[model samples]
Target: MNIVCIAWGSLLWKPGPLKLASGWHPGGPLLPLEFARDSDDSAELALVLCPGVPLVPTYWAYVDAPDLDTARAMLAAREKITPGHPESIGSIPAIDGAPVQQEIAAWLRGRRIDAAIWTALPPKFAGVGGRMPSAEEAVGLLSRLSGETRAAAEFYLRRTPPHIDTRYRRLVEARLGWRPLREAAVTCPA
Candidate 1:
């Protein structure tokens, strides 16, 4: 099967064990992406697909896996999602008729990609009860980060692909003065 992995966040820059047969290509699929998940690992508001939010462009790359299950497992491992929480990783052969999934299915059919997988971690904040954070709230969280945590967040924001701009990204840029690093210095953070 021609499986591919879609990404819009850290996976692009820090793909740990996802075997990519090719580099990321633009025009993957437009989804409602936002920095909504407060990640424990990165200590930043990690990006996630948020329903009803503005759709943003994403990137996709060919996975070296043999089938959808393998691809999903690889992505789950890369994202540190455990097996029990299978919902955290989304696959093209979805269970429900989610509009976003339908849109992605069409995109996959158009590209002749047999299957696709993506990080489907939900939006989470400390006291929000699973609701996504607003741009203002996200910036408030970022503002409170210090030391390496702050630097890592800044690095993550700067390293994201320019075309993956989302509402929260703009707010972070405006409020925290964090912009995408110049192309010449796009290397991973130290």
Candidate 2:
């Protein structure tokens, strides 16, 4: 059975204990990624896909997760989704639709890669009664943050997937009205 973990966020930069192979694609079907969720450990805003403007592009990486159950457990643990929702690993093309996922899937298969555990759970409800925040609301919340909280927010904005969109990045940066977080990782390297 094929088992590969899909990474479109921090996993792109830090794979944690999963030991995923090194390499990635500037993935597509730009999903509506937003910093609508709060980080329980860090107390800051983090990225999570939710229904919104499909502007942010996605990035994908093939990680080594030999066991399907283990892969789900690891991702759920990392994404902080406990008692994982009924649709945790829901379906591929599940959210992005068949065509988009098919394009990406076929591309991977052509290279002899099949992502059996394709992707992380959405961050929408990742938190305890967490609500997905809007771009404007996010910007407003960001504008009020200070210190480490603010830094954590910046790291999140910079690390998300596909590839960074400078326009949107600039918009977020402009909203915060502060210099971007120092060139540092929001998450530790594995």
* Alpha-carbon RMSD of each model: 3.6, 5.3
Candidate 2: pairs in clash:
58-162, 59-162
lDDT of 2 by residue, 78-180 (tens): 6566763624553232433322334345545555454444443444433444465546766776777788887766666655532444344456767665444
Candidate 1 at 100: error in angstroms? 6.4
Candidate 2 — what's its lDDT?
A: 0.53
Q: How many backbone clashes does candidate 2 have?
A: 2
Alpha-carbon lDDT, every model: 0.80, 0.53
- Cα RMSD of predicted structure 2: 5.3
Error of 2 at 32 (Å): 2.8
